[model samples]
Target chain A: MANNKQYHVAVVGVTGAVGQKMLGMLEQIDFPVEKLYPLASKRSAGKTVTFKGESVEIIEATPDAFEGVDIALFSAGGSVSKQLAHEAVQRGAVVVDNTSAFRMDPEVPLVVPEVNPEDIQKHKGIIANPNCSTIQMVVALEPIRQKYGLNRVIVSTYQSVSGAGNDAVEELKDQSQALLNGEDPETNILPVKSEPNHYPIAFNALPQIDVFEDNHYTFEEMKMINETKKIMHDSELKVAATCVRLPFFYSHAESIYIEIDGDDISIEDLQNTLKDQPGVVLEDDINNQVYPTPLSAEGKTDVFVGRIRKDLDVANGFHFWVVSDNLLKGAAWNSVQIAQQLIQQPGGLK
Target chain B: MANNKQYHVAVVGVTGAVGQKMLGMLEQIDFPVEKLYPLASKRSAGKTVTFKGESVEIIEATPDAFEGVDIALFSAGGSVSKQLAHEAVQRGAVVVDNTSAFRMDPEVPLVVPEVNPEDIQKHKGIIANPNCSTIQMVVALEPIRQKYGLNRVIVSTYQSVSGAGNDAVEELKDQSQALLNGEDPETNILPVKSEPNHYPIAFNALPQIDVFEDNHYTFEEMKMINETKKIMHDSELKVAATCVRLPFFYSHAESIYIEIDGDDISIEDLQNTLKDQPGVVLEDDINNQVYPTPLSAEGKTDVFVGRIRKDLDVANGFHFWVVSDNLLKGAAWNSVQIAQQLIQQPGGLK
Candidate 1:
């Protein structure tokens, strides 16, 4: 493929939150798209989404929808990806999946460009994007791990409602307004939409993000724990996570504790390593009270790292507060970055 | 000094949030109060606080305010407590101080009645109340520590605005409404009111609760770490905390991880130990989506425990989600419980 040649790009689940974000990010980043296919479920098929100031019709996602597509970004739920991703791959298109369907698949490489750009080259016609929480954590930890060598990690996340999807975002708004008006907020989706019980996410924190696994950990937490290990490629590293949902509309903030293998690493060493890392911005200054909050990191593509400090008792332990736009760096922008990596390979994507 | 005898009680900082809660708890519990003297700073001296459907005129807090008082409940700032607690104690009043002034004092015993009631007997004139975050955590961990023998602990707190005082609570409400209305929320009191820079806590999470100490841990986080050891009487316990202030108004929730000493401790064993403990209500039914949220635990005195699970990798490690009314069990109610224990002593309070 030549640099001047354009590619036919397809955005699957184009009407969903991250799907919509993928479309906007493609336009913002000026991806070389000769033709755009906005694909969705049959219910949302006829809907039109604006791209480059022109309306693009959403077509029903089917196996044949990938006919001439060069890259397909899948942001639909896991089942949709499970059903359509391979078909897209078989049609000679590289699929960058945003769902968790193939994240743990040994055959598919899970890639965060900042942390593991080379993993994109190992994909077998499909690449898996990590979870929103896991993406930001690994991005912040990767530079430190490369410099200091990570031994263990313990993370507690303060996630926003947007990570659940567009409906959860709407539910958060409705519930917040209803509560402000002193009425009971209707809850149809939250914690887990498919689960039997739903909790209100307005002005409250929900401990369970996805449904529980047999081991009593929510699948969301398990995703963070397992995906961090897979992305970092450190199977022996100890990682633990507690993922909670808060009422914010964008960005997820994490309180992370990491133990470095070396005992001589200072806060300055960690800050210096993260300052030069790609897609990461260090915003730590205790005297100025500067640290990243969810709202502060909204609409940003960079993972903001701050509140870096050494643990009082643990000699090699350090703590950090990492925040990033869950939709951008966590999902849409990351998928787009991987697609760009595929495009920028010498002789282009094979 | 007899059990049936009514005692004179002085409620210091009567105009503040926790002080007002103290007055309500005293009335709700029907403590044997012969006369109630509501004492505040000179600025709030004329304000009236309601008690048992009667208005009590607020008097200026002076050393003479404790002339006839058997117990003085102090919820004012630490400076006020440092300046007045000793004076009140010198006037023959048993002071149960709620500020952080004397919590770490070698002579002062920090008491949580449910966890360490015997420590109340050793108070040298003043019994210090532990920080709100520490009180709830120690309450939830005491039963497990006693039965299983604890070795290490780590906690991340989701604290509410009320823990910062009443003005901070009002700021949260104002900031939330302002943000909802598409206006920039004014930040006069949040993260730290006295600090030079303030961050909005409406839809954001602030990692710093109090000012940063020399060790880079915020005063609030340090309090949780230091005070927990003092209350538990275990100097060898490894405790680390990351305290974050959320947008809620009443309850503080904590995600706590602990490593028990015994290898055979199951989730059932931890649950059984906490189920029978006083002031702890176990709400750990995952099937029913039963877990304690700040909204669900508001105005409740008991510490609600849920989401009990064993760590996936660590054999002896377990995790818990604990919630309690920060102003109630964390401050006012804990102080009242200490006073109750003081009265229940065989010879009454010395």
Candidate 2:
């Protein structure tokens, strides 16, 4: 059982939506683990989670909780990560954080395994996960960048309600039901949780996905803009984003307009390159109604790319639709992939 | 009662989605009438509708149904309109058709009351109501065009399922419930009812809104392209559309990009103009989360315009988002507004 001596991996905030998905992904990928610890807030301490066909009781997360843990996966809120993330790192555990608390830090590697796996080596004990919208987009664009150098990216996202958390999904459901029942709906948690005004997400589209930033872009939009450059390790890559929350419950979709440095590349050539890329699925047959939908990509880990066509007048511009499970590829699966990549690196595990 | 000796108006296909909205508009804005006839197919012939607090029986639409009618509003499917529209016109009724059946017909004047009310007089016998997407875009763009000539328009829509008809709404509802219940959902309509396959619209987005046409664009997309040109009465205008159906049930939202002939127009000037325009509400204050959303625009007749800004790196390009109830500004309210405009004109009455 020497091969089983991999690592004792602990999942912080195990009761939350993204944390649950991380556990499901861990089982799905069958990660090499010596032991698993499920930690949550004190209120959820005694709750049980099914991990790899075994029920594990959740423990209250604290700095002392990571005494012997080799890997700590953090999907808790940003405040929680800010509080305990350094504590976990101080105790000699490598932390893969799924919050924005450490993502922009100069020391933490904002990693998407496919796009910046090598960045993992430079992490100062804490590797940060890029925003969900940024994760799927970088996944689709990285291979393209490697093939044809990227110059600019303009993305408009159709994000799902689940990205706001489980409560937002329930709010959408309740509001839709209220509308159908010929009653007025009550909205308290969408378009931004901490914001004063709540817009109904049922049968509607909201242009602001997250709280507004001083630059006239929402925080969600800025994440895509800033995180893209950080993940690609190119501060000069021009990026803009318009993040929108639609009435979808799962999977985030984006319409991306990208300008490549090379002009002679036909759409067919780009399609051929994307078709062979790892963790990417091409669904771009426009004639036969073949394209990716958020519902179809709900439980899948692969980023689905389609609508690959040249822009009407721009010579080097290409437009495509990229969709992936924001909770999976955007969060849980990417963390697991990063862990696996860290294990596979030349310097063996501690 | 003697003052009731006004023109006799007939509403064909009165029981359908757009037809019902037309009826509501007729009631909401007192369209003068001596008598009103509600005509539908055999399936809805005997149904009773309350118009202006009076129960009006729906008559079966036939050639003789328009005998003494002065104005006819047709919103049935294309086949019904193609067959019955000519008959209504021959019977001295000025038919305002709301289907794609006559939108592209050279002899028909496609009208949006604000943009092309004068075009209503040019109708051979019938005026066409442009597609819902086109109606909203042109209404927002016409003022801009008047101030600075418009050269090109490229729009991508996040449309609602209700645009397909009442059945598509039912499919979305049923499929959502089925998916949430962990059951296989049924899909009998959508993307095109006559097409071979049906896809579940719950938690999904379909790129094709209507049947595919010879030009490789869906009929809905082509309808937007052709109808925009026709409604603007400028055949030389370059219009391109990508119409996508999201799971939204009410209002349609569009991201419109336009290139104007003038130079160096500031975003503030554009916002001020839209704020003063008729049937348009400006909601472009990004500092306070003041952007127009489909939920806020539902059941409203005004086009909610916001996110107005100059395109980056393009001199004459500007981008905006427009939202309005598809059933209102796009179809029913537009038809009724045209009728009111005609009534206000010199030769509008018999």
Candidate 3:
């Protein structure tokens, strides 16, 4: 029942945060790979990355690097992905992009395998991975939406620093130590690195995740709002998000409120639906004081869903606490899962 | 003309977190305090607190401690307030309780000075200070409500550890230091100290702010919901809250979404209303990356409001980022303001 043929895979941006996670996940999941190419920028080309206890030298991520690659995982920044993804596709390799460049493109399918695996069939050689915050939320809400139908969603996120890349993670650690030593935090590379006026993210929460648009919503918030509507295939669905970067280093936690289409939805109903879902784990046990936290879900692949409760005032409203490793389910693991799905599909890469 | 007459003031729980803040605020505002009594638990009775460069001895909080005391600010705890508030009231002290002991008592007016200072005139001996999260939110929203008429409120709080008192703050600091040193965190106080199974709050976000009730909502969430309705004097207002505890020490941040009663309400309208409102500062210049964070609002008296925007889908929906020092505007300063109101009233303590 299983295809045992191994294919050549290329992991782009191999020196960065999510790219490193992609290499680790590919080995952890034991993906069928005959050859591996670890590609990064010219500055990091000579670096070596470990895969399956074997050291692989990083190569430059150029257009010719995608030749003979069956699946290419791109976790570089948006510009790098935009410059090279089409080249990979033109070389007959399926591209799973982990950036915002192609996510809202109708030609590319934004997919969470558990929620919309069927959407991949519509892809034109490139599949877009949803934002880390968006991926965990859709995974937790899809079962509920399927059973009761969702009308509205309002989410507040406590995102970690790793989503910004490895440099931000180092900044958080250094700032935490400095603050604890009663020293002023050295500030740079947070709440949008390119923007002026950087604020320290250690022991603090920055309300802005990305640059603000004309509408006052940050780009990260818009990604959550827009990508959610596209991935769920419901443009009429009401979605709003407030994305904040916290001091945590790995996982992102969200406080989600959703209104079901009809009345009489119970906590048990939501719990049962989540428990039966493929990539969701239910951890809600209020009596034992059980719920999901970012630190607890740091290295986990599945989205941890907990804190399920019916709204006190709204009859159809329900609340949930969702948590997952941003690097895993939010980026690398989701891209690898798409690659897994691509290999599993009949003639998926032809 | 302002009254020059002084009054005898009592600061209950003087050795505790909010109690110390109350003492500082009383002096900072240059209140006409002829005499001051600092009361605390018996264990902390011998502690000395400084006021206006003078040291005041901490006395044990007892029924007789309020004798001839014109105004008593109670912040010790709920049980302590419940036991001694009436005793102090019987002794002719106008009690401004900071705990949830009598907030929803119907007879006890829950007052935010900027929002409903007039409600203090209706107080029968005791005026309850609303919950910290509720106080800042209502202060920011009251102006909008007065101008546009509010129909619904949905808030998610990123509350700090100091709101749980000094022990929780110490836990956060200790856990943070330990985690940074690569040691396992020793958890004792958090997400309700009375509840079993404490989770580390150093680098994590806990969804539970207080222990859960039968309906699966935490007591803290219910407090926000019920207190908002009562404080606004609008029972029909649809309000929901999901309160989470973060690792920050002083200020609490809220992500609030509100539906106005009428359509065509613009962000400019909301900004103009907030700009003119008392005790509320509008810091919403996204072009310069101006927004309030908990660190920036620490020790501030005003409720900092920003991130104001109109919802993309809901015609009347508006969103805001509200931040304030939970101990100041939320607890201590609000109580002191109520005391100030009491002093200005004719025959206030008679």
> B1-350 in candidate 3: lDDT tens per residue?
16688889999999889998998999899999999999998998887899999998899999998998989999999999999999999999999999999998989999988888889999889999999999999999888899889998999899999999999999988999999889999988987888878899999999998778998888899999999999889999989898999988889999999999888988988999899678999999999999999999998999999999899999999888999999999999999999998888886454
Q: Write the residue-wise lDDT of candidate 1 on A1-350 in tens digits.
A: 35877889999999999998998889998999999999999999888999999998999999999999999999999999999999999999999999999999999999999898989988889999999999999999998898889988889999998999999988987887788888999989998888998888888999999888877788998999899999999998888888899978899999998899888888888889999888999999888888899989999999999988887668899889999999999999999999988999988977
Clashing pairs in 1: none
TM-score of chain B of each: 0.98, 0.96, 0.98
- Which residue runs of candidate 3 sit more than 4 Å off their true CA positions? none
Q: If scored against the real structure, what TM-score would every candidate get?
A: 0.98, 0.92, 0.99
lDDT per model, in order?
A: 0.91, 0.85, 0.91
Off by over 4 Å in 1: none
Per-residue lDDT of model 2, residues A191-242, tens digit only:
8888878888877788887777664567887788888898998988877677
lDDT of 1 by residue, B150-170 (tens): 888889999999999999988
**Over all chains combined, what TM-score does candidate 3 have?**
0.99
Candidate 2 global TM-score:
0.92
Question: RMSD of each candidate?
Answer: 1.4, 3.0, 1.1
Any idea what lDDT model 1 has? 0.91
